[model samples]
Target: MPTNQLTAGVCSLLNEPQHTEDLLNSTPIVQILSVKKVHSNPNAPNPVDRYRIIVSDGEHFLQSMLATQLNHFVDEGKIQKNTICRLDKFTCNMVQEKRLLIVLEISVLEQCEEKIGSPAGLQIPPGDAAVTPSTANQTPAAHHTAAATGGATASTSNTTTPAARGQGARSGRGPTTFPIEGLSPYQNNWTIRARVTNKSDIRTWSNQRGEGKLFNVTFMDETGEIRGTAFNLAVDALYDKLEEGKVYYVSKAKVNLAKKQFSNVANEYELGLEKNTEIEECRDSSSFPVVRYNFIDLAKLQEMAKDSICDVIAVVKETGDATEFTSKFGRTSTKRELTVVDRSGYSVRLTLWAKNAEKFTNTDSPVVALKGVKVGDFGGRNLSMSSSSTLEINPDIPECHALRGWFDASGNSENFQSHTNSFSGAGGAATFNRSELMSIEEVKAKDLGTSDKTDFFSTRATVMHLKADNIAYPACPTQGCNKKVFDQHDGWRCEKCDRSFEKPEYRYIISMAVSDHTGQAWFQGFNELGETLFQRPANDLVAIRERDEAKFNKLVEDVNGHQFNFTCRAKQDTYNETTRVRYGVQKILPLDYAEEARHLIELLSSPWAQ
Candidate 1:
């Protein structure tokens, strides 16, 4: 294992059919010459970026694709130019008349400052060549290799190359099945062997076009996953034919740009099934992977943007009874909320809708695995299951088993931090972990609002003064909107909404000065923080100001000298052609002296304190 020594002739051996089996079996050391990031489709709603690296074996260099599972190595800067790595597992395939090696598993050996040796591009073999299946039934590794390499049946004889298969597929001859990862809009006559990971119930929609019934299913193979949809007659023909967790040979479907708003699959293209699309069940599906998940911890959900889709796994801590509500269109639906806690010691609320809400009855702290759940910013951070989302309770997966064991052992006794509450409260006592806590002096020293991105931090401070003038404004009353409205003598008009209202709703936009032991800074807050401070609505304060000015001033004075914990967001703001840092209140909570005392005691008892 000498440093900078590479296994030469590895790329040349990859092109030779005789060395395919041996090369696939042995791990080869190689040097990475360069790395490039490619977006599958730049126009895709949520584009998938993959890394392509050129690896050299001291003599020949070859282009390779890094599997999505190993993308973190590139993202985290572990694998880069001149880096030496050992390829533990890989598969070679010919795509678009070029050779490609898909790196499935790899280990970093060393980082080099310069290239190890002079290497030329590996020559492509003559004629249309493809890997042929062995005489034996395909093993898990062989099967995955074939899937990444594209097109091979279990039989050794009558094997077809991927290029010839594409041509044959169009000519109605002996067609070859393609892998899901290599599928694109240009290839129409392609078949794929994939398992249905999730299927949706049939639903009817009415739009500008005629109404029709449709459903969609997510398909996964060894390489990647794609979403497929069937409408009208296709729905009637294929709705019942597809089942979750079942493998099938699918062909003759249309490949088009993916509708990302309706799907969270990483693939850039989606399949459209027609009535004549061919689909058949594959009984021997031992080689296909069951499912793939990229779960985010409950605590990490706070950092993610709102409305993003993600996967999560946790144990059900508490479940609420199903509640019925009527939509604005008069359609009734049911929704249930559950509090889920993970090993990260954080809990978040998850809402289930419709049939899922009505049928959920697991009361013994079952492990819940959710995929494609939408994140929300309401009450800090929460999750809601969309129509395309999937939920599994107490699945037989290893993560579920481990979570169940932990919950049974010690989770039930541990107190969990909740996303909905600013602090963990018990018996009228609150606690702060102080992980994000900062002092006013530290906030100023860090220049929190100088950057383009907003900075969020928490501080314990007391209100010094409140500016009582122009503290409230007339705003449009539309839900989810707080645009200021203009009064035109008779009625209030909202330019953004292009509508007029009889009157306008009054909302607080108050400015206040807060101070800690170090220093003081001015902060601006909206309706929520204002109500919390005044213990009343902004409209009441407005009415009181018009009738009795003395009472309004007295109320503002009462809020002064009150101590609280504040979460604030700071960002650079441009006003009147001048840019400056603007501080806004994100959340406010009453100060908990008991928790502060406990935190101080723990800090004093630590060895570092001595």
Candidate 2:
């Protein structure tokens, strides 16, 4: 029995009634009599990483553990002899011959702040202490003898080594762990053992709060996955030690709602590592799952809303040439696109950014699995690797292996339909729809594209005529700029732009007469639109024209009489004081005659129709 704290004092509970025992079972106030030198492990193979302290309430004295996390408090002269502390969390467990007092958290009230009686044995009722059946080997009399000198333990030797004591144990049982899904911003005092599946590059950021470097890791277990970040000193201490696919025992982290803008993990909460966080590598990670993936099929990607972060696994049907360009923000970026397909017989585009683009190796159209790709609908449905996204080529996932096998077998024979349109900027006219659309004749009537902003409109037009000679030109191969170029002796040169390129991109700049029932207009089609119209790459057309002039003429004549739903950007330009409306095909869509007829009907029925 122990005295209750009347006012900011100390108290303890009697260890009796076995299962009903209190004290360590509940939060209490205790006074430290002396910090013990060490404790021995008579049963464990090695000593554990923990310390012992003799604590007393006004009446009873007991031996308690100084948790490894709070060892710094003792070294820093914070929790010493005669210090009174309120046990924030603690437990009492019976391990064979030892009754261990384990404290998870504590708050120091003061050290010898108030004068009281000397630390002594519990003052229980006269007969109550003597008749306790819980006292096995030690009688009530021997209990006092043990309390006077030190705790009653099986090992009286002082040979317990620090290595054995550092095993992070006190009672017989080990730390209890919970799943990541059970974690939330409101919960506390939980431990989780998980494997690091992904690790982000160390990045530094600054704001009004402060500045520091941070690295992120995706931790997953059989239950679920969550993200953990270490900052500044924690980064230097833990980053090098934490490797992907390694398991770790972590506890005492600050959990909060995850920021959707930065991560694609499904967890509602993320962890923030603190100085007191206990992270140690686990020798065995057999319990952790390999990973968790909610992969969206390539065919279903087009149905997803824009900006949604999702995962996908598909076989690479083709890969684009890598390109390096400066973004609008003045930051240089590298990019490449992959045309991927799945069993659904449908294809879509995937744009890998920065280092991923530069390091890509699309050998033999490998199966590519990506996580956290941002869905985009610039002109049509597409995918772009997000900053926090991860890319894996020919991964070992089941879907990846299946896709690889299928592509090698029957997938190559089946023609796949593309979910995306022309190329990158074909999305230039993506913002416009049937409502904002106007015919080529209406474009001329309204004097469109002359305003500061280029007027965009879609029309159902047929290629009635095309200039068979010199319909294509050699242009700068560089991405972001497709201006025409000249074939100098050494290489291709764009004299007007004052730039020379080692590789010249063959691009289409064909002059064509597009006609509709309303009227006809001249439209110039560029590389992407030209490729779509002729169903041949600009480079192929250039080669055919150079190899055989008559063959080039035949290819140009092939596109004639074919109708298409075209999205065009109109701009007026004047050369030699002869200003004319220049209609450039921004996007070339499949001719859906029924959809086109319905769209025309809507335009004609409008009140403002001419």
Best by TM-score: 1
Question: How well does each candidate superpose onto the true structure, as a TM-score?
Answer: 0.61, 0.54
Screening candidate 2 with a backbone cut-off below 3 angstroms (N, C-alpha, C), the clashing residue pairs are 47-164, 47-165, 48-164, 48-165, 48-166, 48-167, 49-165, 49-166, 49-167
Residue 501's C-alpha lDDT in candidate 2? Answer: 66
Report the number of backbone clashes for model 2: 9
For model 2, how does the per-residue alpha-carbon lDDT over 396-495 read when each residue is reduced to its tens digit? 7778778888889999778987665434344545443655657766878888888877878777788999986666777765555667888788777876
Off by over 4 Å in 1: 1-31, 37-49, 57-59, 73-97, 107-118, 122-177, 327-330, 420-610
- Candidate 1 structure quality by residue, lDDT tens digits, 416-464: 9865323221222123326568899999999998987777777888999
Model number with the top lDDT: 1
Which lDDT value does model 1 have at 25? 69
User: Global lDDT of each model?
Assistant: 0.76, 0.66
Q: After superposition, how far is residue 487 of candidate 2 from its true place, in Å?
A: 7.2
